[model samples]
Target: MPRYDYRCRACGTNFEVSRPMSEASAPASCPDGHDDTVKLLSTVAVTGAARGGAPAPPPAGGGGCCGGGCCG
Candidate 1:
C-alpha cells in the first residue's frame, strides 16, 4: 500500500491515508470527518545508496563555461 497526503479545506487539517494505487485518486475524509478534502502533491525522499555501493564520480573533460574559462 502507498501513502497519500491530503488536506481538509473545511478545517485546514492535513492527514495521510494508505491505500492501493488503484484507489489513489479516490476521495478521502479527514479525521474530523470533513468531506471537503483535497489530495496534496507530496515529495518522496529516497534514502541510502543503491546496492550498498557508493555514488559514481562525475565525468571529467566536459568543456562547459565553468570548466573552460569561457565565463572567466
Candidate 2:
C-alpha cells in the first residue's frame, strides 16, 4: 500500500492515508465528515543524495573541511 495526502475543500483540512495505488485517486472524505474532499500529490524529502534528480544543497559549512570536493 502507498500513502496518500488528501485535502478537504469544504473544511480546508489535510490528512494522510495508506491505500492501494488503484484507489489513491478515489473520492475521500475529510476525517471531520466533510464529503467534498480532494486528493493532493505527494512529496518527500531527500537526506544525503538526490534520488534520480538534481543534487540537494550541501549541508551547512559545506559538508566538511574538504568542502564537498571528495565526492566529485
Candidate 3:
C-alpha cells in the first residue's frame, strides 16, 4: 500500500492516497478542508522483470563498444 500524492495549499487540492509506510509522514487533509497539505513528489514508472529469469550476460567485452570485436 504505497500511493501518495497530495497538494492542497489551502485551496489547490490534488489528492491520491493509499496509506501505509508509517503514514508516509502523516498529515493529510484536503477535500476542501485544507490541512495545509503538501506531499506531492511522486514519479513511479516501473515496468520490468527480474527473478532468475534471463538478464546477466554482458561482462567480457573487447571490441570497443559492445559490438566488441575490434573497431575499424
Candidate 4:
C-alpha cells in the first residue's frame, strides 16, 4: 500500500493515509477528525544510476585531463 500525505485545514495538522493507488484521489480526513483536508503533493527522489546498459565511451578527442594527454 502507498502512503498519501494530507493536511487538515480546520486544525492545521498534517497526516498520512495508506491506501491503494485506485483511491489515490479519494478524500482523506486528518487525525484530528477534521474532514476539511487536502492532499499534499509528494516528490519522489531517484538515487543511483540505472544498471544493465553499456557504459558510454569517453568523449571524443579526450576532453579530460587523463585522456587529453595532460597526465601523459
Candidate 5:
C-alpha cells in the first residue's frame, strides 16, 4: 500500500491516506462526508543504502554544519 496526500475541494482540507493503487485513482470523500476530495501530487522522501551496500550520506547542509562546508 502506498500513502497518498489528498485535498478536499469542498472544505480545503488536506489529509493523508494509505490505499491500493486502484483505489488511489478514484475520488474519495472527506471525513466530513463531502464529495469534493481530490488527490494531491506529493513528494516522498526515501533514504537507504546503495546497491553496493554503501550507506547513503545525509543531505548536504542537513547537519547544520555551515552548509556542509568547513570553516575557512
Candidate 6:
C-alpha cells in the first residue's frame, strides 16, 4: 500500500492515507468529517553526497605512504 497526501478543502486540514494504487483516484474523507478534499503534491528530500549532504564514512583497513603496496 502507498501513502497519499490530501488537504481538506472544507476544514483546511492536511492528512495522509495508505491505500492500493487502484484506489488512488478514489475520494478521501478527512478525519474532521469533511468530504471535500484534494490530493497534494508531496515533496521528498534525500540526504547524501548527491544532495550535498555530509561526506560518506572512510573505508576500513590501514594505509601507508605508498598505500602499503611497495614498502611491505
Cα deviation at 30, candidate 6, in Å, is: 0.3
After superposition of all CA atoms, the RMSD between model 3 and the true structure is: 9.5
- Give the worst 10-residue stretch by lDDT in candidate 6: 57-66
Candidate 4 Cα misplacement greater than 4 A, ranges: 48-72
Report the C-alpha lDDT of model 5 over 2-68, residue by residue, as the tens digit. 9888889988988888889888787777778888888898988887788799987667765445765
Model 4 worst lDDT run, 10 consecutive residues: 47-56
Please report the TM-score between candidate 1 and the true structure: 0.73
Strongest candidate by lDDT:
1
Q: Quote the lDDT for 71 in model 6.
A: 62
| Number of clashes found in candidate 5 | 0
Residue by residue across 1-72, what tens digits does model 6's lDDT show? Answer: 789999999999999999999999999999999999999987887666733576765444445555556667
Model 1: per-residue lDDT, tens digit, 11-50? 9999999999999999999999989999999999987665
The digit string of per-residue lDDT tens for model 3 on 1-72 reads 998999998788799889999989998898778788899889989755556776545557643565677564
Q: Clash number for model 4?
A: 0
Model 1, backbone clash pairs (residues 3+ apart or across chains), number: 0
lDDT (0-100) at residue 33 of candidate 2?
Answer: 87
Q: Which regions of candidate 6 deviate over 4 angstroms?
A: 46-72
lDDT of each: 0.88, 0.80, 0.81, 0.86, 0.81, 0.85
Q: lDDT by residue for model 4 over 1-72, one digit each (tens)?
A: 999999999989989999999999999978878899999999987655347666566677776866677865
Local distance difference test, candidate 3 = 0.81
Ranked candidates (TM-score, high to low): 1, 4, 5, 6, 2, 3
